[model samples]
Target: MTKSYVVRYVGGPLDGRVDTLPDLPDEPRSTVTHVHLHEGPKIVHHYDLCYAVEYGCEYRLRADADAE
Candidate 1:
């Protein structure tokens, strides 16, 4: 079975959202991109990896890219 990890998103519109991702490499991507689609156009949010926790990792939304 493949191992998965839980990712907690903090700040921005996606704050408090938790996602399950596949096994990550020793050095995971510094940032994660999320495409959000609501009623209108799609907005992209970039989250930077903060630190590792017991179960998985936590990512914070980048300030520069937090405009809605």
Candidate 2:
């Protein structure tokens, strides 16, 4: 049997504390994992970086096991 879960992201100015999203596609489920900055390309520029830093860049996505 396959297990399901809800992925919630804690980000943006609103804090996204109450925001939650469901994962689709039953074949494969989504899971959260840590990523290094060097692993991906740098997209944030001067303004974007400053805004993100000032507002706090602590967006954490947690997967909560769904109750079946």
Candidate 3:
């Protein structure tokens, strides 16, 4: 089975949300994409991995990416 890690979102609409995701690389920094429905269009948001915790990782919304 693939290893799963607890991921915590730090900012944006998903702030404070936690999810268990599989196969997140153990890198200091990385990007995760999220798709959401806004009105009738699908919007994509990018988050950057910023911190590592005991058993999880913390990702913050990218200001530049979120602006797009």
Candidate 4:
């Protein structure tokens, strides 16, 4: 099984506390970690880096998130 997670980041004018959601950037600020999970178990393995979006453009923003 494969799942996707939206990587949230705290940068730009919004630092310290996160009271509102941040806007997406224009280029990749960090490595985007894709993952794959087995059917028998819920454990997931780190897959690859999504360098570009569907439109072939790179997103610019650091993603700070840990899997649960």
Q: Largest lDDT belongs to which candidate? A: 1
**Each model's total of backbone clashes:** 0, 0, 0, 4
Q: Pairing residues by index, what is the TM-score of model 2?
A: 0.20
Candidates in order: C-alpha RMSD to true structure: 3.8, 15.5, 4.4, 15.2
Models 1 onward score TM values of: 0.62, 0.20, 0.59, 0.21
Global lDDT scores for all candidate models: 0.83, 0.34, 0.78, 0.36
Clashing pairs in 2: none
Q: Candidate 1 or 4, higher TM-score? A: 1
Candidate 1 on 17-39: residue-level lDDT in tens? 98887877678788999898999
Q: What is residue 14's positional error in candidate 2, in angstroms?
A: 13
- Sorted by lDDT (best first), the order is 1, 3, 4, 2
RMSD of 4: 15.2
Which model, 3 or 4, shows the larger lDDT?
3
Tens digit per residue, CA lDDT, model 2, 1-68: 54433333353322344323353335432333433356678332111111134332224443233523
Which pairs clash (backbone N, Cα, C closer than 3 Å) in model 3? none
Task: Candidate 4: give the clashing pairs.
Answer: 26-60, 27-59, 27-60, 28-59
Runs in model 3 deviating more than 4 A are 1-4, 21-29, 52-56, 65-68
